[model samples]
Target chain A: MFFRRTRSIPEEYLQNIGAHDDLLRALFVMTQFDGRTVLDGVDLAIRRGEIFVILGPSGCGKTTLLHHMAGMLPPTMGSIQIDGKDIYGIPPAELDELRTHMGFSFQHGALLNSMSVLDNICLPLREATQLPEMLIRDIGRIKLDMVGLIHAQDLEPSDLSGGMRKRAAIARAIAMDPDLVFFDEPSAGLDPITAAEIDNLILKLKTVFGITMVVVTHDIPSAFTIADHMILLLDGQQLAKGSPEEILSSKDPRVVNFIGRTMPLADPAKVDILNYVAGVDSRLPEPRGANS
Target chain B: MSPSATESVAILMPSRFDRETVPALLQEVRRGIHEGQHRICLDLREVESFDSAGMALVVGALRAAREAGLQIEIQGVQDSVYDFFSLVSVERLLEEPQALPRPGFIEGLGGLALPLAEGSQKGAILIGRSMWGWVLSPFRGQKLRLGKIAEEIFQAGNGAMFIVALIGFLLGLILAMQAWVQLKIFGADIFVADMVAVGVTREIGPLMTGVLVAARSGSSIAARLGTMVINEEVDALEQMGIHPNRYLVAPKVLGLAMATPCLTLVFCTMAILGGWLFGVTTVGLDAMAYIEQTHQALRTADILAAVIKGATFGALIAAVACSLGLGVRGGPEGVGRATTRAVVTSIFLIILVDAFFVLFVKLGA
Candidate 1:
């Protein structure tokens, strides 16, 4: 009710990457949490390796939609098909086969804190492949280096900062070199400097490896900056989705209100694009001169 | 939507944020800083409030953005949230000069940790996680969590120590007192020491300790394992095609088996000591005679019986814990219920198994 924008017809629906842009699909899928619908009769498709951000306010179900894509959360009434294969109908064994091609970066970085950065990064390869330990280490090292964490290999995860933990998680996500990587709030709890580094890493993973990513996050700028395609979910249905630029420019009040509030609050009228930071106002003075 | 957020989280913040909402808003702020943009404005119009939770996010974001040398601004907050923020007045505390100071700890840890997890812990942790993966994973799938000899031993043996010691002490005292009361009528009260020594070392000491451990530690294992199973940690493993049980379950069982016996030996000592102190010094039995009778009754077979019971009980406990953990329900509450059930079930099963051991040693075998 607080977000009372009239539902305008989203313009991207016509050229919307809804069908042709679909790399995966679900038919009438539902998930129940305590007889309450966490996800109810949701139908949607996600494209491959495209950094597709799932955006929503808290309780809007951004994360739930992402889990469906990763097969982490199964729908109660519907089927999700990955690469055209119905996930529910497929045996559990087959689902695993599909997962080797997919990677997940959890909100906590899900790095096994019990493990070292290298071990967390190469976990997938060791679990799935018989590649020698040396080989796993080599690959893990490469990815850690990719995340700029090559120096942190032997250290336990407990020692890393919020940004480093995420980078470590990214290393783990890309270790198997899966075609698709799912990032659940890749930028949460990080400083802007570190968060941007992670965002750039997301873009690099896609650009360099051609990996498809489905990110679940409330960070509007990170979503707009990193995502090629996007989907907005509310009450277990797709509210709207399109390219980042399109989603941003659209007059759909729902879209406008969602982005407008979350975007760094500045005088929209006086705010100069060149002068504005994505989440902060440029009006705040530099600290160096004052401190001096 | 991601269950990890609702259920768990991505690379869970290494540690929980001191305040929850701050991190969410901080993330938004970080997004701005990363782009190296000069000015950023965050409108809290829809947010409707700026209490600790809301302000935490805004201030947290501003702090990070400032540290990154980006200008920060807040606009359009409702009365309630803004009032709460002012009430706390912590916003001014968070507001400061630009740029965050990089801590040596963060750089040091991630710098080294990422490599090792990617290297050594992969196989071991995967094996450990997989044991109960099938029963617990959100989607039906293959996975592995438990495996490795040392790990199994630790899970089984170490985790159950507290329960074992507690049971051992209580059982020892109970056995001595009960034996004394019944024997007094026959002028056999002096035999309480012998009875306690033989009974404890020969069976009760080892067996009871293990069963106790099974109940306490086993159930704990089950709950922890169960949650991991349903939460997709197990599925994540299986998707990687690692065997779940051999890695996850094997280690726990073996760990318990190895540790429970050692613990049982300690329990035996304590139970006998408790009985001796009470029966001889307090109950008026001749110390020398009691010691001799106890020695005579405590034969090699008795020791074997106790050790065997301890090992068996340990194995049972580990198996139950691992199985329950793996078979836990889907949600957090479900995982909790499974943990509670695992303990109750494991304890009961341990006692039942102990009874079978007693029967077999005495007659059936």
Candidate 2:
């Protein structure tokens, strides 16, 4: 539990951010075991009113990248900034203030089953803010209502289906109307209908609050549909960066294989087919869409 | 003057520092610079994110890089992080970190099964929680310690009552029938009444019923509660500021304490009735004759002794059940094991307690 993600008011976020803002310049970066850096040298600008998505393959470390951005994880190198101040530059009082406005959704929703959905949603506020019960309930009701989960507020998280739990978790994450939000693999466990629903909810939040968003997912379709800006990572380094279209058109073989629009010689059977059946040499195919 | 606030500026930001990210990135940088870790690679590998602390660290790193004549490389930068570098001038200044060799494909194969490498961390939590409960005596208050008297009654007495009554009645019948068979072999059939009445009221009724109650209820309480303990729900409560001992164990102990003695009395009554039924039917002894002999045979001490035994056994059974329950290990299987231990221990303890009660009453107290 101690190694888990943290959020606080601007003051607290600032406090935790103390003295660290001077050094950091990377967002959600991880080093490779072999000392060859992956998620290579990614730099991003997530505006206050934008949907920024890091779209990549299963091993591209998009989730790791998201964690870096959200402050759930510490980067080996680099800094994240909020407002004019580097996220870690602010004083403790200011940092705590910042954590209050940022909402993070874990991949599994991670709702506490012992708590009712409403109470689960209310946890961050209870931990961080001294808002009155009535105020908290009102906020919870509003968030749940916005997500169409008002009726399910009293139910335990286990009682709800997978999709409903995400909505409830989202409601909880946004219980404070955070200015910035980070979501991890929102569509991973959900069916198409539910995945689409979560996507739509994400878009709705973006549009309504004009809040900054950083989303991480392997769901290519959802990522393309929702990302205002998308970046791809390969082997812990940024494989490609730009729009969803930019990623699709990447000549990088790793990028081509990941987005699934292009064929790459990953399956051993595919290589055999090319050499024997297609009358081609045993070699990796050149990417068709780099700089397109 | 400062290139107009809106214009993006290139600040020579620190690249790799330590494991932390964001504002703390700069903090580490500052500390390093203060500690003179110049020419540092603000390694982007481990960094997750940062707030102001990261920014400060970056600034400190940059400043250190400049002062120490040490070069800084902010390599492995994610796109979102690039914005910070540019704003701070590191985008224009810092170079990328050096790349080392990659593992060969064969060596890399070991890192596979990430497909199967699902983190089983969730299970560890459940085990840690129960073990913590077992180690920490959370089940202690003035009147409500884990092995304390009140705790035992709720766990043992109430849970085992119905089973005790049923077993006691069956024991009475079996004892009566056994006596009746032998008595009928001779012309002393009427004396079967005396045998059963004395047997049930004095010995078999109290002792057998308590043992049966211990077996039926004690094990069950241990298993059910032990499973709860092992599952980490108890630890979760402690984390949430609710003391598990007070919230979970106290009430159960209190409930069992109140329930066991009453159940024992019921068990004794049922057994006496069972004995009377067997005596009248099998031996052809008139009910009045059986009643008169039983009255002649029975002593107030016997009744007192049995009731007293019931009370003591009830408490003992409860204490043992709770003690076992509180000792639960993680997982469903651990619960089953605890249940078995609770029943065996309760039965053994009940017999031992019964011996002492009878001896003490007969001898002096």
Candidate 3:
């Protein structure tokens, strides 16, 4: 459950840490699937009222980390403290109370296809509050307006375009004016314009509401645009944690390769296509003839 | 106690602190806090009933008081209210209470009973709504898809006709042949017709048809709906605010209900024909005399009972199938399990229902 800090904490990141108290703190958080570890000894401190984006390649446990942070999945080791309360250690009722102030936007809209856009937005409000239909409808309308989905309120999730569905899901996520919001791959599978629009919406929501946002994505452009602070994960390990500028300038080879989109070079002497294909030894063999 | 300069007067809590009373009570308590009361005490001795809304109200007031740099205390708390607060872990606001003991075997049984009761309740609602869907369709401008129902009827009943006829014919022949050997010893071979007609019409015809349909159509229905559930189409329907029972189940129930009795009639007629064939060819009895004996043994009530049983079994099979299908989870494996469960449950219910009908008939007689 011990994580070795890979690099010195960036001065700006340290300043950001000093600026606001941590709303979410993960201490030695680890997750295992079957026998293999998915997230290994991860430590993170997400400050309040800031956009914290988790950047990772596929299978790097970005979504898993997000789920752990959101209390949807329990870590194999360590603890996640949300607002100084141990998320998993609390009783169900207390956990529900904590969750009431939080919202999660899934990667795929996950909007109930049977419900109209309006009802999808209204669902959480209706479930969590005893407010009358009229008030609930007004609130739903406001959220739809925020997401620019007022014209499509009467249509089903299936009837809307993919970007519209994502917006609708975002509308539903923010419907309760939650203190914390988590978005999983908001810009994934979206066109660049739609993706930028989603990124802008994320920024606007954070700016206007002053709510903390945690976005998990591999979309590098989207991450750079929206993140005030970011964590780069590789093989379930934190490779770097800092602002986008610091991350871009990181001397770490992995960070440089990832940010620069550089492919790892392979030496001809170390080539073993057959072994690699068989998954027997994926690592490059030692140089056999190096100018000898 | 009277209000003093340093000691605040405790507000008397209501006996019933539920949704109806809590709103007004919360407002009054908030007003009291706003009126320069730094120390507030709530008298909870009178509380006979308390719900989550009540707890929320009290918690909200406490939070507001704390935010305003005031203090609040609870006094004379009733045991029941105290227990509820402890159960909900709200005792963190006060002092932590001892953890309650885990439930034992009997409690586990009671826990199991809840879901069973809930499932039965949901089944009843499904049945009621499906029935109403048929009854009110015309007025509601919702057309019952006769084409879909017809397809189901054909698949469940008409396609089943060949097997029903084959089994019915074989049963009649076997019954008459078995009875002929004994009757021949006493020179009463004419009674073979009587035995076969009564046995097939009263029991075997309806029972065999039900079991066949249960295996054939019931499993199919469960598999179809279970796949739909896996595909999230059922969820889609639910999201659209349409009841799966009314949309998916009602047509099948009505179609099978109509078709079953007709199949039962065909089964009984074929069985009698088979007996006549056996009596004339093998027993050396007069064909006309055998037909007359079979006719004499057959009662109008017996045919009516068989038809009623057929209709009831049909409805039960469809309902059981639909319920199991709707409850399916996981994936293809779940659909397979649901299909197996539907067949087994339908057959069990068919036998159980048939036995009840038999008991009623006997009592009436």
Candidate 4:
């Protein structure tokens, strides 16, 4: 006999992103865990059928922002609206219904290790639809084929390689044909060629299915390749929000530094192995004959 | 007038060709193909809406036509279905299905049996190695860490002291009350003291302690080790050439083995005290006289048996918990399952071992 009060949307939330054609929006979202702020005053809107990339370096709030927008985490302040509805303000049943139109691809794939790849893809469809088993299986197979993982349909998630697991996760995300898909580091842990292929696949999904994607990534090249609009985050703050070209040409020193940094070349003259070892073991006792 | 016209046939698709209608429509299409309609034309101009199932049927039909040396064509497809088809290529369906390798009967049976057999063998090995480490640790130059063993003892024994005392006291009171009814009829009401002391020391005290300890300490041991395995701390120890049996399992086994006997003694004392309380208040027996009778009735062998039973059950609990925790698979979910299995298995083995002692003592008597 437990009762909970239904949350109502604030008037300010309605004035912010309610009038836009945005399929997803975050209005001043802030998150704190154990008194440590992970996301601070983040605001953005994802247009319907556009690929919006959340670009950031490691340890920034890119994934945290994605989790908030996906309704997996409640922010400390502000609201997330999906389909023009404040997701947090709705009741549990309404939130669940809203979640049906959204899909999230975890960075680690997060496929249930006990189930096969095909079962993982079919999970949402089987739970939500009244379709026959054969039809569900057919749809599952089609999703697997779309990700080029049909050959691995029967294999467990533990059996898949990193790249294959990512592909399978993507297949599961798109299994319900959701309107909004969140991809967390889609090209991460993939080889250069495989990463490029994933980028191309993202583009293809956007163009053919018109599924709106919000990709969170630290990879500069991958972001530029697939992003229609993007926001760069640094230390839980949005540094820049614009197209890829705009991000590249951004006058902000942090954004420029993040995009412009490259691998430092090693100089042969400065490569002294003995000196390096000596520096590492400075506290070690001198060898018996070293002083002599 | 052309000779090819005899082999060709045309069929109109339903307007709402979806999962519900696809089956009937599919049956008709299959009948046409089965009846040797060589060139089939599926006219979808009338089909306004269709879903993925309908798309799958079309692709399946195209694949079937190619395989059967027949020609199939679809004309005037709608925009939405066309968009879906473009996303999931028809060429994918035309490609041959990959051969999924499935295990045969014998292989499947082996898959089920092998892990159980392996786990049993590993459990035996763990028990053997832990026993050896405990036996040989004193002789080795590196002394066992008394601090860690002492900490475990404090947690497992002292932490469980209150619940054990409460159950012991309640049990003693109930036993005396029940025994008073039968003994008073025979004018042997004084015998209640003897019965309470003997029963508590011989069976109830050790048995209850075993159940309580297994419920409390055994689960914690399993959960800790399982999380350690998940976090790769167990692997880290192995990488550093430190044996897990010596470092992790031995201390717990020794601590619980040492602490359980002390707890059993406490349980026996509390039960005797509870029986005295009931004797003085309800039975109207002289408290000092009841105490003397109880003292005389309890023998050394019975007390030894209780201590031995408590120690054995404690060691068994630690061993079972350690084995299941170290052998965990999957992830956090696997850790939870392992913890449950550890508690159940420990209690089961404890009772089994207690039964063995009961038989041994009866035969000796």
Candidate 5:
């Protein structure tokens, strides 16, 4: 029987993040699905205990980058190091052990609709810990309380509203008290008020618990609000990486348009239906009745 | 090792204190408690790996100590274990379990019955819509794609041809040999042809074909529709003003109904040919005489019965598959459950419908 040989993290990858002593670092990471490149040679570093945001437009590989960082997707090229340990190079068992310290909250609140919210939250603890059922449930309840969703624990995921589902998902993600949590589009489908509340929750979890967070989202205001350090992705490449203030004041037109929402709106008069209808009529032979 | 209430009982934890090993270690603790040990000291110095079950055992021991007015102390706790305990707050584990209100008997009964009632109602609605699409719609100028129905027919019938033929031939050969052995002593060996023809046409051919098709096409339909429901493709169809029953269920139901009888005809022919082979070579009967005897024994009623039973079984299978598939909920597990239930239920209903056909034939005779 042949086995795929596993390699250890190389020495140079450690030196790559040595400058800032970064906790999580991506070096020239590129991801391609089939022949289509989704993430091009993207490089960024996340310092320990900071709320790092990955901001991009729709289909700009924001989630793809997060998945790669979490060791869910192997990059087409380049290396990702979590605390100077190569995520893709190591053996699967080591990767599994490393992943136990991290949590991923999916974009769709991918809670198992078959189970109650409380059970969903307790699932990780039940699987990973030797804690008694009651103790695990207690931990689950605490997690739900942290997300302000204690009362909705008994309800199924399908019963919860979009915002409530996202909160429930967050509760499940933090159930393990992971050192690092990856949140994918936490504010995607919620109303402004609910979205702001989620942002505040994210801030509170960081400030109070001091858990390092990597948030991937296209919502600019939410990103700016929660992000201590941020990176902007455009067309699968890193456009900019800096503090939120630095990104806000960038001179690039694309960055400016993305940050300030200053793109020109369509002129209604030029796009009117009557104009197009008349234009189409003038180009064709006139109707015999109208000509007559 | 000796049990003493005054002296603390020291137990060294295993390297891998997981769910599998926790039970035996727990039994050891229990045995010590029964042997009059008042204080237990669990040593975790050698422990390299621990799972939820290990923590559960610790919590259980703690709870037991407190209730029994004894003492329990954990020594040399690893950093990983300590981190988990600290995060969850060990005090929270010691708290008494909260009592939740249990539902009344009537409420519990209603809880089980409500889903069943809802499912049956949905199943009825699906069957009605499917009938409308299969039988009524074409007469009313609704143009369902003939290509889709043709594809389903090919899948249900032609795809299953080889297996059906093999089973039918084997069954006929076995049945003829058995009948010959039994009839040879009674000087009725020539009646083997009559028995095989009647049995194959009236019972075995349609029954075996139904079971095979149910396992094959029924599971496929259920899994396909269940995945569609999970992926919101079913909802997409509804959004586009297309009835899922008409678009999806009708083709499958109509195709299976049409194809099952045709398959039964082939199965019956193959089976008679097998019996003829057995009677001539093994039993030393004339081949031409065996064919003539089979023709004389098989009535129009038996052939019609086989076709009718095959069509009914096919329709039932499709209906069950489509209903379960369209009604799927939750995730991939839900799709899996639906598929399993579809195959089991289809097979069960096939046997049931077969029994009913046998009764009807007996009564008609």
Candidate 6:
């Protein structure tokens, strides 16, 4: 007969974050994949009672940063502090305890297709609490109402529309009334109207429940509307960090170009068209006049 | 702002005082109380919503104030906050708590036993449902596809025939050759035919066929279904409200159960032929005489026993494979591990079941 043993972390190795005013702090965090650095010595502090958005172009390690902060992936170096405790230094049991106070929503609404929407929302409560089934159901219903999915609670995840699935996933994320909620591309595939509605919901949750939020997205409009603080990442490095307006006004060409979606161009009248047709070397013989 | 004039200090609260900010807010409140302000009013007009942590903060503040010979009053509590306070029974925080009794060994045992019992009950229900589907399929107008059963039968039985035949023939030849040497000293070399016939029909035939099937078909079934699970096809089926066992496992079970006995018969015939060939070439026994002796040695009960063992082993192998497949987790490596586990577990159980059948046959005799 075989039995699994749980490994425990020693107390002396755990870092204390009690002096920090920030709710979550990352100190010189780094992540490497196959000896290639994906997140290079990132230092950030997420203040309490704020919507902190991590904005970047595709493949800029935004999702990797979120995963490290959420404790789903450990940083290669340095530490992440959540609620004054080092996240990576904790034992698995203690880490699970910490995670109960945090919720993470995936980019594609990773709801279990085997369960109904109501069950999906109620799963956390059911697993973590000894609450009666009826009370759990009522809580699930309330979450559904909060997400405007009350009528669709009985439907399977597959039966839901894309927006509905995202809403339902958010509902499930907030089911336990977590202190912090992390969303990955919450509005990636939604229409503008639905995306705005999600943004409104994020703001409402922050104000009404006082839930600190960390959102990773490339949706500039949604980020500006919902974020209290924003960080712009370029190629795995922080390009800028400020309020949305400050980010937009940044003198850094990279920041400005990212936010405004502007691409630098040479003057069309600078004789570039013929040079491009003939190739970069102006000395190269031009193809015989096309008509000739 | 001066507590000396009014004797009551008013502390303005932030718009949000939930878990993240509660510690800082508590520290500030403690600082105010330490400054000799006997009366404090927490102004909450600016605050919109608060959770359990916020409630705890308020309770903590009130306790701190009382300990300092001060009185604290909460003002401008919103309706939403008040609703949560009432729902969670915030008043209980003010009451003194009782010490709880420690759990003993029996209690811990019972705690473990309860979940195990529940899991066993659920497993029983799953088995019952799958068995019902298997038994009722023919009467239900063939809800299970015939092509699928045929495919499984071909895969499990036909695909395994060559190896099973080879092993069966070799086993018979080895058994007869060994028995011939022992019996020839007593001038009873012909008894080798009887020994091979009885042993092959009653035990070796079914056992070899089962081991081969478990290694071949069992691993294939497990790997196939485990891959399906990794791809979320099983989840997709459940999302469509379809019972996976009824659709996936029953056909495999029913097909293997039907095929095993037939394969066992084929295996036995091959084994008897190999024994006859060995007896004629090595022991100088007439082929017809050896055949007659072999036919005389196999009783009807022996053949029935082989068929029973073959069918039982088939069902056991299929059921175990499907269970392991459905329980797969993690990723591609998980599917590989599950396939290995299914084959190992099926063969182990097959041997154990064979022992039980052997005992039953001995008692009947």
Best by DockQ: 4
List DockQ, one per candidate, in order.
Answer: 0.01, 0.02, 0.04, 0.26, 0.09, 0.04
Tens-digit lDDT string for candidate 5 (B1-365)? 55466667888999997656876787887766666567888999888776545676777677777777767889999976665454344455565445688989999999756654554456557777887766766786766767899999999999999988988888899889999989999999889999999999998999889988988999899999999998899999989977787889988988998899988888888888889999999899998999899989998988998999889888878888899998887677778888887887777768877888779768987
The best-first sequence of candidates by lDDT reads 4, 5, 6, 3, 1, 2
Pull out the clashing pairs in model 4.
none
- Candidate No. with top lDDT: 4
Q: Model 4, range B54-100, lDDT digits (tens) per residue?
A: 87678767777787778899988888767777766667656756667
- Candidate 6, B63-151: lDDT as tens digits: 67777888889998888787555433334334323336888999999975653344334434545677797677779765767787888
Which residue pairs come into collision in candidate 6? none
User: Model 2, chain B: what is the TM-score?
Assistant: 0.52
RMSD of 4: 10.0
lDDT of 2 at A72: 60
Question: TM-score of each candidate?
Answer: 0.45, 0.42, 0.48, 0.79, 0.76, 0.51
Clashes in candidate 5: how many? 9
Q: Per-residue CA lDDT of candidate 5, range A1-292, in tens?
A: 1212123335676465444578898887877789899998788889888999999899999999999899888777778888877777788888888887898898989999778999999998889777556557766766776677777878888778889999999988887767899999999988978988888888877765578999998987678678889999999988888987677546676786575452123534222322233343333222111211
Candidate 2's DockQ? 0.02
Instruction: Report the number of clashing residue pairs per model.
Output: 100, 145, 3, 0, 9, 0
Docking tier of model 3: it is: incorrect
Fnat scores for every prediction = 0.00, 0.00, 0.00, 0.31, 0.08, 0.02
Off by over 4 Å in 1: A1-21, A266-292, B1-365
Residue A104 C-alpha lDDT in model 2: 83
CA shift of B204, model 5, Å: 1.6
Evaluated on the second chain alone, the candidates' TM-scores are: 0.55, 0.52, 0.66, 0.76, 0.74, 0.65
Q: What TM-score between 0 and 1 does chain B of candidate 1 receive? A: 0.55
Q: Which stretches of candidate 6 lie over 4 Å from their true place?
A: A1-19, A262-292, B1-77, B82-365
* Candidate 1 lDDT for residue B168: 67
